[model samples]
Target: MNSALQKSSSIFRTAAMQVRHTSVTRYIGTPPQVRISTAEKCAHIAVIVGTILAGPAWVLVHLQDYKK
Candidate 1:
């Protein structure tokens, strides 16, 4: 179990290291396992937030139908 945890943490560390720190143009050495660009990250966030909001928003928009 401890070994598994260590392995997991190492993977996470590598992933974190691959991420872009601040600048969009400043490149890190390792090709990121994840999207490292600011635009890409923002787009990903937007998609996630939109997806999350969609469920509740849709329900709210159609909520009157369930009232009967």
Candidate 2:
């Protein structure tokens, strides 16, 4: 019974190793081209920056109310 358990454990480990090695899909080619107009690029950046700043700005504006 001990030998049987050891054999099954070894088989499970071997299968897991093979699956781990073979399952990965690698990308070797150049990335696909993407085009964005200047206006659109500016708008995207503005949205991201505004979102990051809005949280802190809101907290600062409400600081007096929070102290109550």
Alpha carbon lDDT of each predicted model:
0.85, 0.91
Candidate 2 ranges with C-alpha deviation above 4 Å: 1-32
lDDT of 2 by residue, 1-68 (tens): 99999999999999998988777645446765887789999999999999999999999999999999
The candidate that achieves the highest lDDT relative to the unseen native structure: 2
For model 2 the TM-score comes to 0.52
- Displacement of residue 64 (Cα, Å) in model 1 is 1.1
User: What's the distance in Å from true for residue 4, model 1?
Assistant: 28
By TM-score, the best candidate is 2
lDDT of 1 by residue, 1-68 (tens): 99999999999988776674445457668866875888988999999999999999999999999786
TM-score per prediction, in order, is 0.46, 0.52
- Model 2 Cα displacement at 23 (Å)? 13
In order, what is each prediction's RMSD in angstroms? 11.3, 4.0
Residue pairs in candidate 2 whose N, alpha carbon or C atoms collide under 3 angstroms: none
Error at 45, model 1, angstroms: 0.2
